[model samples]
Target: MKKIKLIFSFILVLLVAISCTVEGINEDTALLGTESSANLNKIFDISTDNSGKVTITPTADGAVSFKVEYGHGTTSSVTVQPGASTTHVYPEGKYTVKITATSISGATTEQTFPLDVVFRAPENLAVTLNKSIHNLKVKAKADYAKSYLVYFGDVPNEVGTPLATDGEVSHDYAVAGTYNVKVVALSGGVAKTEKTTATIIYNAYGLPITYELATQNYGIGGTFGGISTAVVANPFPTGLNTSATVWKYTKTTGAETWSGSYSPLDSPLDFATGNKIKLLLYATEVGKSLNVELEWAVGGTPANGVAVLKVANTVANSWQELVFDFSTIAAIPANAKFTQLVFRYDDSAKGSGEVIYIDNIRLTN
Candidate 1:
């Protein structure tokens, strides 16, 4: 009985001692000396406090100390008494952290923990053009942005392909007409297309238009030639007044000037009734003048000087358009078309070498 009692008591004492002892403490009854490195190292220590925090105290070699792996991802070690704590905030990612414990004795151990991190990308893109369509020569407008690409369509108003890579582009329609315009943008690997209506209108007339020249002396191209002499007959032939083609120049001299290739219309020019005419002239020399006149084309006939126009002395070789307002012709007996068109030069004065060319005689209503 005594032996059995002794054995049972010893077992009881061992159980009591074991139960009273704290985890990680040595069995020695000696007081804890300067903090130990071993006590400071705990990679992941479950805590009575919430919010993941792990603390490691440094060894006797120095203050509690430790480092983290994979970029300071895990908690560092700190040395202190029991139940002390620290915290670490880890960003979401795929990484591993190493928690190490070092004793004053220069011994160290390490542990690692895997971390998980995840995220989502961006959204779809939208694109627009300031102006989708415009006239040929007019400028179109487009606004710019990142990720989103804007594209113009082949036709107007239709959604086009990706354009961000290309930047804002312009299209000119070939003909004068209407067209559809479009704009599309892409973003975040997604394509978002938007469109607006546009038009190209051309209402203005094109240049280089054609016009008709009217005159009895008028032939296609230029100048009147090869016609019979209406001069001696009726200075003004019947049928040409008020036409875009007829006009007359009078002799500044005695109605007749050149002996060759030129002559007056008729002997009588009824300037008294209301006759109008225009002429451009220059002088050949002192005392000399070139008179351009319209009269009956008969030999030795008196010349009608009333319709003549002249400029003398300068002979500068300049030209001018002389207009005539024949509001009154007392009585035009021939019912004439005003058909006689002539260029007359009078050398009756000392200046004989003078010359003048006449063109473009138009009479309008």
Candidate 2:
């Protein structure tokens, strides 16, 4: 009986040992060296507005380790647990987003994809100036951003990675004339970008430029030349009709000017900004004033369109010089270019049937 009991005990011991060995072998599980595993399912998605901001999202919720790899050793990381997602933002550029996940089973996995970030370029860039010779500034705005990249030339270039929000810039012109301008903008790594160009013309006032000088019926000592800007009276009247005739002259410079009433004067000589325009007039005879009247025209208008500066004062023909400041003329509009000059004289009221003569009419610096 004792032998039988011992055999039963030995059998029990053997069964216990087998159970322990099987349990330990199962617990000694090998690490899933390959990324493929049900414990870890990693996924990544990237998107960008192209305006310098990019977003990245990953699938695989439980304790996920996230990261993004872009150009030049640039990488970022974050982690989210079980059945969830995470986000990341970046500036404009190309990128590779990566996400990693690990499970309670002690196994890990990872995935990667491309990402693009960028901004749109500027458009309809233009220029403006306060005064031709005083101040001029340039400005531009982009469709998707507050700032811009500025360039001056027939073509456009980004000065330094386009500015984030201040796309506006300015420059001053030393002399007056015309110029070409351009601008560029960047967006979406490579989407919706544009460049713009325009022409810029500058003119200054109060400069010493060539001008036309006109006069009415050549003065008393002059000739009785009738002039219509439309008709050029070749060989102006060589002889005066002995009797006095009303005369007029435009305030101009140089000898190219012809006494035709409709002919356009020499091209306007630009003046420096803030320069004042003065008119000098005198009577042909002493103590003989002919109620002088003056009118101003811009870009060659007829007798009345321009600002008119007239004085009805009786004068001593003895060279009465009247000074008129065109810059302050009441009838002349501001910012308009000068074109024509006119003069008329009436001596009948002064009881002098004698025609009046005028001379020394000028528009000068």
Top candidate (lDDT): 2
lDDT of 1: 0.36
Worst 10 residues of 1 by lDDT: 206-215
Quick one: RMSD of model 2?
A: 14.1
TM of each candidate vs. truth:
0.22, 0.45
lDDT of 2 by residue, 1-365 (tens): 99999999999999999999988776665433333334334444444234343434444544334333433244445565555565555566666666565655545666666665545544443333222332345555555544555554433452533444543445565544444544445453444344544444334322222222221112112211232221122122223212122234321222122212222223342222332433323344444222222224455432453454445433443334455455655544444454333333332222222333333334554
Best by TM-score: 2
